[model samples]
Target: MLTVMGATGNTGKKVVELLLAAGQQVRALGRSEPRLGALAAQGAEVLAGDPGDAAFLTRAFRGASAVYVMLPADRESPDYHEAQRAKGEAIIQALRESGVRHVVALSSLGADQPEGTGLLVTLHAQEERLKALENTNILLLRPASFFENFLDALPIIQHQGINADAVEPDHAIPMIASRDIAEVAARALVQRDWSGIVVRELLGQRDLSYREATRIFGARLGRPELDYVQLPPEEMRQAMVQAGMSETFAGLYVQMTQAFNEDRVQPRAGRTADNTTPTRFEDFVAGLALDSANP
Candidate 1:
């Protein structure tokens, strides 16, 4: 059996669906029973509880052959870093206690650095904690910035007529769809072919700048004149806070964008055929446009 944490979330839900479709027994964990109802109906054993509670996680991990784990983003947490640390510690403790031999963990491309990467620092620490497990084999999937992140801009674009962020608009970076990440993760969980710790970077179909992506998005939305604005860091942080994110999360988000603009955080191994995923930003935006039109 495979256990999946954050089963109701973006990549986790996809992983659960893929596993069930492949005839694998799955235990899906989430914070809300109601949100997990669909997975339960689809034949997964659903467990709802706090992921930051070690005992709860231990129970959730028990009797599973492998586990798919990720740090669920909580934008409202007052102390976002501390909250992440607590959950990371709980996951590590449960993995040790449950004796799960194989783990597929979702991480980010900039997780190699121990500091100054803002939100990504939590993932770096989690990677280190997972590596300390004595008898377990772990696969650390370091994927690029998610293409899904752009969806958050839909509202701002609709109301303000521009895409805004703290990053340099012309600076190209790797970005991927969460579905590609989930596919790689689900396959790793089923195969369990590697021993010890292994890291794999998942770049998207190609490197793209925010400016180029915005043009594609604008064209898709039938507003080819839409512009991308590089907001001042302070202004961006204030906007994020006004949108209901905690001050801590908003600040960290701005810091991360600064890191990106400075090219301080990047893939260590560079892009290769093995690391490049199939989905293109254009394809992802096409689906997004269709969904918004229908909705």
Candidate 2:
């Protein structure tokens, strides 16, 4: 059995689907039983509980051949770092207790640094904790900024006619679709061919700047004149807080953008076929256009 945490989330749901389609027994974990109903209907053994509870996770992980682990982002948490750390620690403890020999963990590109990566610091710590597991094979998937993140900008672009963020508009960075990350994670869970710890960077099809991605969005939405504006850090933080994120998480979000702008957070390995995923920003934007149009 392959156990998947965050089973109802974007990547996790897709990972569950992929595993089930491949004829694997999957234990899908989520916070809500109702939310997990869809996966349960699809022939997965659904386990609903708090990921921060080690005992719950231990029960879910037991008897599984491999597990997919992640700390889903919580922008509303008053202390995002503390919350993520708690979940990370619980996951590690459960993994040790369950004696799962193989794990495929979702992480970020900047997780190599112990500090200054803002929200990514949790992932860095999680990576270290996973590495300490004796007699376990762990694959750390370090993917780029997600393409789905741009969907958040759709409203701003539709109402204000511009894309905005704290990152430099012209500073190209790797961005991937979450489904692509799920694809990698699913394959790794099934193969389990590697021994010990392995770190893989999943860059998108290519590096793209905010300006470039905005242009792609404009072309899809029929707004050739649309532009991307690099918002001031404080301004963006306030906007994020107004959009319902906690003040602390909003501040960390801006700090993470600063790290991106300064090149502190980036792909450690240069782009290669092995690391470059197939989904392009254009493809993701196309789906975004369809969703917005239908919604």
Which prediction has the highest lDDT against the true structure? 1
For all candidates in order, the CA lDDT equals 0.92, 0.91
Error of 1 at 295 (Å): 10
Write the residue-wise lDDT of candidate 2 on 65-132 in tens digits.
99999998899999998999999999999999999999999999999999998888889999999999
Q: What local lDDT does model 2 show for residue 19?
A: 100
Candidate 2 error regions (>4 Å): 289-295
Q: Could you list the CA RMSD of all candidates, in the order they appear? A: 1.5, 1.6
Q: Tell me the deviation in Å of residue 206 in model 2.
A: 0.4
How does each model score on TM-score?
0.96, 0.95
Candidate 1 vs. true structure, TM-score? 0.96
Question: Cα lDDT of model 2 overall?
Answer: 0.91
Inter-residue clash pairs, candidate 1: none
Q: Of the candidates shown, which would achieve the greatest TM-score relative to the real structure? A: 1
Positional deviation of residue 224's Cα in model 1 after best superposition, in angstroms = 2.2
